[model samples]
Target: MNKTLLGSIYLALASSIWGGMYVVVKIVVSVIPPLELVWMRYLVAMVSLLVVSFITRQKWRIHKRDLLIIIAIGIIGNTISIVAQETGTMLSSAQMGAIITSSTPAFMVIFARLILQERLTLKKGFSICLATIGVLLIVGADQVDLSSKLGGISLLVAALTWALMSVLVKRVPSEYSQIMVTTYSILVALIVLTPFVLPRLQAINISQLSHPAIWGGLLYLGIVSTAGGFLLWNRGLQMLNASSGGLFFFFQPVVGTLLGWLILGENIGLTFWTGSIFILIGVILVIKEKK
Candidate 1:
């Protein structure tokens, strides 16, 4: 099988996991504050990845010049971007948030074209448009009001930061192990989040930690979503051009809708299915693109 094909699969898998992750995060955040939850997520993810690194006998050393780059990536991609996203969602409706996040692929495509000299093929352009429309339909964007300017702008920042991070991942030296990079980047994020999460952590009692649901959610967010998901996503980005890799992010909303239907008893209307078909077709078009 082609490496690019395999990379696309990895990206799709990671995005699908994240689609369900939003659902889990919603439930978890009901019991934990968003910033604190993210902090714990980074902490757990860093440790888990470190364990994996040790088990795999991966080198922990990194080039000095790359240190600042990884730190910047951590701040932009994980900490600040996540904070902005949470703030935007808090101030806006879910529909609006989804619609805004759907633009990330477009930002990534643009960035890859400008920075990496990636070609913006006609087929890729059409696929992005089709996917964006599908997302808007699925998210019921017609109902969203742009009146919440702060929320809208925050989401825009989040989207741009995420796109920048995706491109930056491609800039990492190919000789470096992606898992090591992931672990280090997450550690950097955790360090930056420590002060913010500490005050919140002090309020939690040991009894709260004993709750199975709390522990379960944390583990899922940290181990599965953060550790496993980032590893796969970075690996995929390493394998493919940032523009092509960005298209797989479209899988998030599709899987989210399906999970809602299955787990939350959410209605799956005709429009929803139709939009899903469009998204899938768009994804397929990108996946089939040859290097």
Candidate 2:
């Protein structure tokens, strides 16, 4: 199969897995504290990826020159980003989290142009505007009272952190395999989450383990969302042009919105549809301009 076909398939699968992840997270968070859930999810993901790394005979060693960079990527890309995202979900609705996170592609474009000197086109500029409008419509329909302060701040932090991670990933040298980078980055995330794990462990009642929702959610997150989704995404990016690979992200919010309705029985109002239309338009415009 051609690289474009492979990339498209992989990206679609990644988005679907990610969409389902929101439902799983909602289920698990009911039983476990958000911090604990985050720690366990990454712990499982780390172990799974480590095993894959070993099986594939991927090198674990990094040059001294790249060690700090890898660590930074781990902290910012894996650790901080996940923390922000999960915490944001806990504080706000999953719909809000998904919509805000969709803005990452726009941020990625801006960061590429400013930091990497990549050319930006008017089509992409228009798409970014449309996406912003879509996000606003979604936020408005939700009737989010940012008067709470903390919830609003958390969502914004999640958006910014995810954007930062995207830019950081682009800065990494092509010589480093995406799998190796992802594995190392996840390992660091495990380390960063360690402190929270023990405290949560002490608080958990043994009875909670017997809850089907808890284990099922964790399994879904570890196997499907984190491991499978990420592996496919890395493969897709390897096969496709960077811009094309980035455009695939545009599907995430749409998938997320559908999943929200199917799983959570969340009401999708007119604003939701209108906002999605704008977001889609914006994404198409941006990619066309980039081309």
What TM-score would each prediction reach against the true structure?
0.93, 0.84
Regions more than 4 Å wrong, model 1: 145-151
For residues 126-220, could you state the per-residue lDDT of candidate 2 as single tens digits? 66667777766764635554554565567667666655565566566768777788878778878887876886687877788788888978987
Model 1: lDDT to the true structure: 0.84
**lDDT, residue 65, candidate 2:** 83
Backbone Cα, N, C clashes tallied per candidate: 0, 2
RMSD of 1: 1.8
lDDT of each: 0.84, 0.69
Q: After superposition, how far is residue 195 of candidate 2 from its true place, in Å?
A: 3.0
Candidate 1 on 1-291: residue-level lDDT in tens? 889788988999999888877777766766677788788888888889878888999987788988887888899898888777766766676667778888899999988988899999998989888888888778787778788888888888888898999998988888789898888788778888887788778776657766887889889999999999998999999888898788888888888888888988988788888888888888888778888
Candidate 2 stretches greater than 4 Å from native: 1-9, 135-142, 234-247, 269-278, 281-291
